[model samples]
Target chain A: MPHDHDHPHSLLPPDPALRVKALETILTEKGLVDPAALDEIIDTYQNRIGPRNGARVVARMWCDPGFREEMLKDPMPRLREMGLYGRQGEHMVFVENTRDVHNVVVCTLCSCYPWPLLGIPPGWYKSDAYRARVVREPRKVLAEFGVDLPGETRVRVWDSTAEIRYLVVPQRPEGTDGMDEPDLAALVTRDSMVGTGLVPGPTP
Target chain B: MSRVHDMGGRFGDGTVAPGEDAVFAAPWHGRALALTLAAGALGHWTIDASRHARESLSPRDYARFSYYEKWLAALADMLVARGIVTEDELQAGHAAEQSSLSERALMAGSVAGVLKSGSVYDRAGPAPALVVGARVRTRRPARNTMVEGGHTRLPGYAAGATGTVVRLHGTHVFPDSNAHGLGEAPEPLYAVAFEARELWGAAAEGDEVIVDLWQSYLEPA
Candidate 1:
């Protein structure tokens, strides 16, 4: 199907939703795609996988320094053992959030995200605006996300490619030394894990 | 032949805002994504080939389609190009007649196993020429036989700029060559770190960006 002229671009549906629905119906009717498998995929990306998994990993690391060392040294073995494995997350690299340096992740080419750890990426994460401006004015871009840092603090953006994906491990909250792993995990937010937001203050 | 998809350190695009967590804005988006992944599991085209299909569209068309629409378009292009489906069948939403080709079905119960054991892109290749901490610059690798313009993982923003190899990711399938079934020719990949000042101008001092670049994209600065 040569897509320039024979394919009347004008004939296509302006409404994306309907176009997709029509395509899906055709593919299913043709028996090329299994309906049950499609449902499982939608459900898996929608619910089964998400930032909560990454939070658990981060919390365990914060609570157990030894685990952090092992995870930092070689995460694939430890991550697989922790059940944190999936497509787009084949080779996981955890970037630490320290007082002086903050890490932010973006896929400028086509939104290479860590689906296993962060679930499906947010719409903005894949938007033209974020992909273009974030690399140029990261501080300003981050400030729009309500993240303001001291002038002294630094930022590092990871441009993800197909070979590797990055997950930002936010710094542990202060005065959380007494908190258990679950409690510490509770403090980890999705944005924080992405290094675009601060870890929530300890609960009273 | 720079594809519009290679956007990094590109400025003046506007404000970046947080978005809703909804996986799909419409039901079709979800189905579109599922169908692409499902059909892709058939192994007719490599992931890089599929990506090149989407990126090859005229920039106007590329920007026109929504994310899932692009996915659907790429899926249609691949199916037709591979002879698995005909334009007439695609247009009619049914087979013209019985297609002899058998497509594998991924069961719901096996979704986890299938996704968990994702396709590995690494392949056998020569030893890496450079190690960590070595300074290098991105280069346009030599190509032959196909169209001069196509998809590449190398972001244009850092093509001529210099950076240091902070981490080496061993050898992996090179997407540029892999897109054309140009053998599994794996090459060492590196996490090259560029200071913000080096990428931008004095305006971006004290910041840094790290990109995962293939071995071919690098040359000693």
Candidate 2:
């Protein structure tokens, strides 16, 4: 038999809209989802929301050391208490930074991230190079991202394989002693939480 | 087929820092191809079953069942065109390798191990090195600053950042040509803690940060 070896263009296509539409049709016919509710769900998630909701909780934890400790030991209860627990993040571990070391996270297999607190990860993080090289040569990788540490400092890398996801509780920078919770929340950057870039200096 | 994960120690660089333009380029056709392949396979099986019914069953029964057969005929046509499985052997070899559960499990386990090593594909055990909390410094690579060819797990971001031993995971494994398969050594993995100040200078917050690192990625702090 002569195979029609057209090869069908490519195995992976760039256009996801057609797939999404087909899936929607299949799901509708199967009574999985009502066609009317799909648009509402996508709109609410894509536009209005932000990571600020999770950041507020972390900010509050930062202000209260006892609460911070409790949150770190068991984040689920705390997240439920704050009513910020939902979607992809069911558990969390807040890794604190001190005078001696730094923390960075990578999902060696896939982009497993703490979406509850940080929302979606940046494009650079999901790249193959970042995933492959970060665990292999963290120091050099961090330097390329403009986070240079001294030769004497020790770099520790975390490869997230299990369900336990991580968030870096960056040591609160100096000169923000009196800042309130909301203002402090503004200081927290997604990169700091991931241990890539630090929290930028307080605005001006 | 080579497992997707095993990549390491094979001596060449695979790191290609694709620019932004290339990253955003259209590449979703790959997904379509997968869907098409699946659709074609299903079509082939359906046609074979229908042909069997025609040869064995009475004309009346075949007519009764023919209405129920919708995409199977189209699927078969597509499959025949693509040469996935011939009309004669619709489902012959499908269960050949998968029939034995134990054999399948063993093959899967070995493949998983090989994929994890990020090196040449082999079914060795783990890597041997320092303990998780044992203070170990990273050995500077002798050549190729851009490439990592040493016994270290120090990530690019946490390089030079130090911390204490936290957890010991397991031994590291990589493919070994010397063993003609996968190789392993008794090495400990650790979750090292670093202070945010050390990583981000003045911009850091709180007191410390902890990272689960491997034995190969640390040096005595």
Q: DockQ: which candidate is best?
A: 1
lDDT score for residue B11 of model 2: 18
Model 1: pairs clashing at backbone N, Cα or C within 3 Å: none
Taking all chains together, the TM-score of candidate 1 against the true structure is 0.94
Model 2: per-residue Cα lDDT over A1-204, one tens digit each: 322233211121123544334433332332323433443333223333345665676678779989888877777777766755544355466667665767777765345576557654555565556666665566666776778766555555666633356777776778888889999888886677777766665776
lDDT score for candidate 2 against the true structure: 0.46
Worst 10 residues of 1 chain B by lDDT: B139-148
lDDT of 1 by residue, A19-135 (tens): 656556656666666689899988888778888899999999998889998877778888888787778788888989888898999888887888788888887888888888777
lDDT of 1 by residue, B1-221 (tens): 57777777776678876864577877887787887888887778888898888776667877887777777777777777787777666555555654444356566677778888776666678778999899998774422224477567887777778999988787888888889777666888889999988878754456788999888788998
> DockQ of candidates 1 onward, in order?
0.59, 0.07
Top candidate (lDDT): 1
In model 1 chain A, the worst 10-residue window by lDDT is A3-12
How well is each residue in B1-221 modelled by candidate 2, as lDDT tens digits?
A: 11122121111434433233121123222222222322322323332222222222233322332211212222333433445434333322121121111221112123222222212111234543555456644433311132223122233445556566665444433111111112243334455655546645532243344454445555786
